[model samples]
Target: MGVFDGVVSALRSAGCVFAEEEARLLLAEASSPGDLARNVQRRVAGVPLEHILGWAEFAGRRILVEPGVFVPRRRTELLVHEALALLPDAPQPAPPVVVDLCCGSGAVGAAIIQQAPWVELHAADIEPSAVLCARRNVGPMGGQVHAGDLFDALPPALRGQVRVLVVNAPYVPTEAIRTMPPEARLYEPVASLDGGPDGLDFHRRVAAGSLGWLAPGGHLLIETSQRQAGGTSAILAAAGFLTRTVHSEEVDGTVVVGCLAAGMTQG
Candidate 1:
């Protein structure tokens, strides 16, 4: 059998659904036969393909995704789409400020700037590895990356100036995490996956703190599962935002958007 055939067989035997596609990608990444062999072994051992490739395609952009960092998922493109929809029209003196919380690899923020080059972007993550990786991706795009828990990572100067806030925080319940695919449960960090008991913990925190940071009439967008979308919207409403849920059947994605009233500029 040819080298490609052998690699596909190894990947298929290891339970990879898209064995042919994975073999092609693995072959493209391997510069030498030894490298190809090593990559195949790693794939067989269950390392995520994105982690092996060191990048992920999100919103048609190649986002740098380092090992141990949370890989961006295709569903998150819906969050980016909704956030872009909420942004006010362009052509202004000062560009609208955008902040991405729990930014991981900064895929969402990167995608935003890719479309709207005028945005002042900032991304933050609590994990050191994520912060470092995000910097590599967001920095080249002229966006800043911060390391800290949630809003704390952002500069104090950004308060009340943020026009758009996007978050993709952990939403998997502690108990439910056990049922997640091994690519997430085994490869991704627990802090990046666990969301306390009901998986709405970060939603509550982000919603409660969002009002003080959002500009007048600014919008907050959070990625969540369809099952948890209602709860996410309810939390935003309770925190004084005008909330709504948006879903994409094509991508099977859900996003909760909260808008601060135009009349209430300050908290």
Candidate 2:
């Protein structure tokens, strides 16, 4: 048997769900046998398959993802689909401002901008590593990326001017962390996956700061868990937003949309 036969057997034995496909991707990405061995060893050690490939296919685009960065999930495409539905195709009668908070790989904003080229897209993240990765994505698209906590990273002038605020922050509960798979538990950052006690920490912050930045009738769409959707909607409703929940059973994803009515908050 060749080296790959042993590697494939080892990967399958380790419980990789797609050992054959993974082997192909690894073999394609590796420059030599040494590199292939290293990547295979990392996969055998339980690092995410996407992390080993160095990119993820999201919204039909390839997003760069370093080892430590949060891997973009297929479920998050629901949030992107929801945001696209909320906005007009960018040859907008007038250009609109867009913000993507907690933008891990800048995938959401980049997807929106790609669909609507007239968008003035901006994205932010609390983690410096994510921020760096997002820059690689948003920068090429003429989008700006800031690194800081929530609205703190957004421009002051964007206040009451944003037309779409898309977010996919961490919503996994603290207590649930222990139950996650070894790849997520060991590879992803605690801050990127942990969402405090009830897992609405970022949702709470987003609701509190959203109205201040949203123009009259602007919308904020956030991805949350199905179990937490009701509570998240309540929080947004209390913040004076007209709220609704959109879910996709296929992806097992849920998103809460909060809209600021025109003249309800500010002109």
Candidate 3:
């Protein structure tokens, strides 16, 4: 059999759901026959294909994804789309500023910038690996990457000036980590996957801190599971935001968006 056929067989035997597609990508990325073998081995060992390829496609853009960094899921594109829809039209003295919290590989931020090149993009992640990876992906877009807990990593000047806040924070329940696919549970950092008790920990924290950073009439868009959308919406409402939920049946993605009313005082 040809190398491609053999590679597909190995990947399929090792539980890859889309072995043919993965094999094609691996072959395209491999430098030689030996490299193809090594890539195939890594796939068989359960490493994420994106990790092996060193990038992921999000919103039609290729985002750099490094080892141990959270792989951007296709579903999270819904968060970007919802955020893009809420961005105010251009006419002001400055472009809208956007913050991507828990910005794993900066995929969401990178995608936003790709679509809205005028945005002033900033992305933050607590993990060093994610920070480094984000710098690579976001820097080229004229965006800045910060390493610290949510909100703290942003510049002081950003307070009350950010027009958009997008997030794809960890939302997997603590216990559910053990049940996630091995590629996530074993390859990605726990801090990037565990959402504490009911998976609303990050949502609550993001909501509480959002008012201090969002501009009047700014919007906050967060990715969440369909099952947890209500909880996320409630947190946003309690934070004084006008809350709404958007879902993409095509990608099975759900995003909860909260908007701070124009001229409204912070609560």
Candidate 4:
């Protein structure tokens, strides 16, 4: 068989749904016959294709992704879209401050900058590998990447200055993780997938801490499953944000957006 056919057969046998397309991508990215073989072997072994290719496509951009780093999902683009919508249309005296909390590969933050280059961006993650991978994707765009848990990773000066805070925090219920595809459960860090017992742990933490860091009238957007959208909105509402949930059927993306009252800025 020719190279393309052979690759497709191998991927198909391994249960890859889009084997032909994946074969094309692998063939295109591979440097040589040996490299292609190795790439195919990894995919068949259930390593995420993004890890093998070293990047993921998000918001129409190629985002750098490292092995063991959480891959950016198309569903999280909803957070990016909602955030850009909340930014002031006219130029501000100072650029809008945007934060990507729980940033994985910094894909969401990087996409935000691609569309709105004027915003001051900062991204943070608790995972060391994710923090390093994020730097390569976000640093070149003039965004800062920090390492620490949740809000702690950010600079204190960012408090009450951030206009848009976007998050893709883990929302998978702890027990449901094992049921997830092997590509994720086996390869991605547990910290990137575990969302505590009910899948709202990070959401609660983010909402509770957001008020102090958000500017007056600032917006917070969180990516969540459709089933968990109401719970996420409620968490934000209880934390003093006016909340709404938005979903895109095309992408199967759902986002809960919360806006602080215009005069509610805090230190």
Task: State every prediction's TM-score relative to the real structure.
Answer: 0.97, 0.95, 0.97, 0.98
Residue-level error in angstroms, candidate 3, position 236: 0.9
CA lDDT, candidate 2, residue 56: 89
State model 3's lDDT.
0.91
Worst 10 residues of 1 by lDDT: 258-267
Tens digits of per-residue lDDT for model 2 on 1-267? Answer: 777677789799989888888888888899999999999999999999889888988889998888778988988989889988877854766679989999988888888888877888999998999999999988999999999999999889888889889989989999999999899999989889999899999899988888778988899898998899999999898888889999999888899999875555652
Best by lDDT: 4
Task: Give the Cα lDDT of each candidate.
Answer: 0.91, 0.88, 0.91, 0.93
Off by over 4 Å in 1: 262-267
- The all-Cα superposition gives candidate 2 an RMSD in Å to the true structure of 1.6
Report the lDDT tens digits of candidate 4 across residue range 1-267.
Answer: 999999999999999999999999999999999999999999999999999999999999999998889999998888888898988666678999999999999999999887888889999999999999999999999999999999999999998999899999999999999999999999999999999999999999999898899988888999999999989999998888888899999789999989996666677
Q: How many clashes show up per model?
A: 0, 0, 0, 0
Tell me the spans in candidate 3 whose CA falls farther than 4 Å from its real position: 89-91, 261-267
lDDT of 1 by residue, 71-112 (tens): 999999999999888775574699899999999999999999
Name the candidate, 2 or 4, with the larger TM-score value.
Answer: 4
lDDT of 1 at 94: 91
lDDT score, candidate 4, position 220 = 90
lDDT of 3 at 128: 96
